[model samples]
Target: MFRKLIEDASTWHWWREWMLIFLGCIMMGTAFVFFINPYKFVPGGVYGLGIVLHNIFPSIQVGTFGYMLDVPLMIVALLVFGGQFGARTVAAALFTPGYMNLLTRAVYPNEAAVESLDPALLLNGQLNLSDDLLLTAIMGAVIIGVGQGIVVRQQATTGGTDIVAMLLQKFAGIKFSTGILLADGAVVLAGLLVIGFGLGTGEAGEKGWVLTLYSLITIFTTSRVIAYVLDGASYDKLLFINSDHHDELRRFIIEDLDRSATYIKARGMYTGNEREMIFLVISRKEVRQVQHKIKEIDPRAFLVVTDAYDTFGEGFKPFPSADVMQAE
Candidate 1:
């Protein structure tokens, strides 16, 4: 059964890709409807601010508003970035609002206050101290994070902030992590202004601030969790080994450690001697095994190991950071 499932998943067809895309959309919609919308929380992105704007004016639907806002951003991204980027974002932009609208329409009549209002205990008094603001934020963030991780795995997106982040990274030469932080930070700050501080006083404007804080906390937590989940648990090290017994070392790594290695030719700068160099990327967990294998094969091998960041492709996927881990 497991083998069949794996085989089914490995089938590289349009239907499979579409299935993943649809699943990603549904997960994103659930996050918006069940958690974000219910709590009146805004995530980091254009959609976050759109929710706030729509909330202020009940006449405006969040889905429609979000779509309209993202349209221009998508255009900008396409113009600034490239056709592929624009195309990818366009799918997300269209699908996100469509899903949100569908969910909103379907759930509109069933609204009977999913969350209750009680001043004594926060979050409707259902969640205890153990599930306090911090915990709620962390859990919510994690859920969002996992959803996003899955989305990325499928090579799709939830649009809004993701498009902005990618555009900034490509055009401005900004790092993806930094771009995401900046984009999300702006939305969170806007949320703070609109939501007001919910600091026990229960002032008219204060609840909005409280909600804003909650949303920001949730996004921050989720982002961290997503990062960690995509990356492996350990910081990987890239090793370049040069030794007389290259074949022996390679065999040891392949057979004992079950890792593949690449060989390249290198020449000494001063000695003018050409030698074969072996390079491998290994997880921290396997470092000890690799070291032992190398020692057993050839103690005189010249090995250089360097820390690697965010490796992708065969052998491993990206792992989420502490923040991302907490999010999921």
Candidate 2:
């Protein structure tokens, strides 16, 4: 049974999914070691707060603390987000702790011994101005954001706060983006509290606030960029047409529009009558053309259009293409 399941997963492109997850792990690990951990700059998510906590209380291992934190969130996800989402969260939660543990052991040792590239700035207490807070925060955000984008592209997550967001979205009817805000907001607030207590009222305290603000900015900017880059090229339109003039519509799309169409059997929900459904995936620009063609065939045709954010096949963007020049 286990072997059969493994084979089934393999057939369904499990290796590609795992590769994306591994890429996320590398990005998260690098962000932790290079930016967040070294500079004591926390991000917005659970991992961000973990960095702060790890700095304040060096006795507790970050990996262990992070795993402990994510356990309850995963339970909430299971109860609220259903089996598939919960299962994916579980995979991410498990992988994160192990990955962080390995990173700590491998990378943290080299951190203290390594010399800063901005050694002169460090000697003059100008490291923060030069490349300390802002640089770390931006780099951390970019790395973590790209990692998250890759995971999301594969229809997975890094668990932690993301699980909480999903659960809130499912159970509380909160928007996913808003849920993310609430989850990460709490962590950022915690980081502020930690910094306030640790650095009292002094120049150091003011500097801490600056770091916090910059970190927040970095996280937001990086995540947005990742989402935009991942989504921009993938937005296509899937059009479904059911009409008496199916032949005309199909001909127009194939010949005039230079698009392909697939015919499928569909039933009217109200009438309970069999019908032919014409399905075609086209670029956003081509949607208007498809609409015009449908109208030209039958103005009364039942048409349904859905946004296809990621389509993998022929005649789609991101496929190999030959450059062509238009003569004037």
Candidate 3:
């Protein structure tokens, strides 16, 4: 078993997975070091909690807390969930914090600089958008969203509240999304009390509610961006064509577009007429092409198009992520 594991870990596909993870880790690290940590933005995750902890213990860096949380969490996850998630997850969880720590040290000369929250010291004042915290939150959200999205695509998680989310899904029969929101929501609320209310560092301020609102923006944007990454920019178009030029349109789809369609016998409810409904699924870009062709072939051709959430078999992904996950 050990030999097989070692051999599996050395394959080209394994390395490719690691390469993507490396890229993802770098993106996430960039978000933390340059945008998030400096501003003390708690976007909710292990790192977000780390930010809150760093405020309380100014001597320790946020990334250090990440390591402390991640290592134990990784072990607990492995024991509880088993190894179906693969080792790439462990690598991602470990590497992200190391890279964040490296970048943070490179940016801030010492721990004092981090606690000071001096814009001039953080990122050399280039990204001191604290004055424009909203913009900072949005930018950070986009970056972290893309980063975490990439990590998630590889069938691995960064191992924080995601573990909690998964556990909730398994035992409590809670939806994964709802579990995520619940876990991260609690963390954000903790941030509001600790950082905003100055319970952590004992420096009271009015930014608690304001920061809470901004954190919500970050969380929402990050979730959307991650979803966009996973689902792609646009969904496939499901086309239903009922037209005089059915044969011509079918030829255009099969011959020109190099795609296929199905025919369903149907009757118009109001007209009491029978016709073959041409059904097809095509990429978003091909929608316009198909529309124009229908217009050219038959001016009054009845055409209906709807978003195809997932397209499988022939010129599309063989299976959806949900199916692949179930099979695993």
Q: What overall lDDT goes with each candidate model?
A: 0.65, 0.66, 0.78
**TM-score of candidate 1 versus the correct structure, residues matched by position:** 0.64
Query: What TM-score quantifies how close candidate 2 is to the native fold?
Result: 0.60
Worst 10 residues of 2 by lDDT: 319-328
Tens-digit per-residue lDDT, 162-209, candidate 1: 666666755676745456667888878766666564222233363566
For candidate 3, what is the lDDT? Answer: 0.78
Instruction: Put down candidate 2 lDDT per residue, 189-282, tens digits, no spaces.
Output: 7677676456322224446677678767766765564555345445588888889987788678878988788889989899999988988888
Error of 3 at 129 (Å): 1.8
Q: Is 1 or 3 the stronger prediction by lDDT?
A: 3
For candidate 2, what is the lDDT?
0.66
lDDT for each residue of candidate 3 in 1-328, tens digit (9 for 90 to 100): 9998888877967778768877987998888787777667788889899988888887787878988988877887787666856476788888888888778877876778866656678766776777888888898889987877777677677878766766776678775445666788888988898888998578855667788788888887887777677666656999899987777987898899999889999999999999899999998888898888899999898989999866768788766644122111
Best by TM-score: 3
Residue runs of model 3 more than 4 Å from their true location after superposition: 1-10, 84-86, 166-179, 320-328
Which pairs of residues collide in candidate 3? Answer: none
